[model samples]
Target: SQKIEQNSEALNIQEGKTATLTCNYTNYSPAYLQWYRQDPGRGPVFLLLIRENEKEKRKERLKVTFDTTLKQSLFHITASQPADSATYLCAPDPNSGYALNFGKGTSLLVTP
Candidate 1:
């Protein structure tokens, strides 16, 4: 079975600093990777999507990079703030037309 691995440990960073999170996968090669942010009581919110052909993508203070050779993706939040704290989930779509596989997610805590 395909599997996604995210840091189970909570990532702590100071406000105004960059926070980098990682997502790794095995047993599958996806055409696209999706990133989501989830708060405590709310469902995940779409953040960004990076295609396999694309090496990097950015939106505002967020950036994502996909490395097909490494079978890994990195999500980055620049100049992060306390409000940016949340659980980030990564979904790798194997171009199955209905990609629904998501990892347990990594928790990020931005401190003042």
Candidate 2:
């Protein structure tokens, strides 16, 4: 079966530092990749997305790199802060009509 999973632990870091998160998978191939940010009890907010054929993608304060060879995705947040703290999710396009299958998620906690 196909599977996807994120850190599933809180990543605590100091403000102004680069925060790195990871997503791993197994048993299936995805068509595209997406990243989302979620605060406690809130639905995920779309961040960045990269297709399987793409190398890397970025937004103002975010970057996402996908390596199909490794079947992994990396997420980065620069200039972090407590306000930036939230759970990050990695979603791969399941190739089904809906096009999304999300990993559990990784929590980010940036200290002042």
Candidate number achieving the greatest lDDT relative to the actual structure: 1
For residue 74, give model 1's deviation from the true position in Å: 0.1
TM-score of each: 0.97, 0.93
Q: Model 2, range 74-108, lDDT digits (tens) per residue?
A: 99999987899999999887866774788999999
What is residue 13's positional error in candidate 2, in angstroms?
0.5
lDDT of 1 by residue, 42-89 (tens): 999999999999999999999999998999999999999999999999
- Where does candidate 2 have its weakest 10-residue lDDT segment? 92-101
Superposed by TM-score, candidate 1 places the C-alpha of residue 1 at a distance from the truth, in angstroms, of 1.5
Clash pairs detected, candidate 2: none
Q: Which pairs of residues collide in candidate 1?
A: none
TM-score of 1: 0.97
TM-score of 2: 0.93
Query: Candidate 2: which stretches are off by over 4 Å?
Result: none
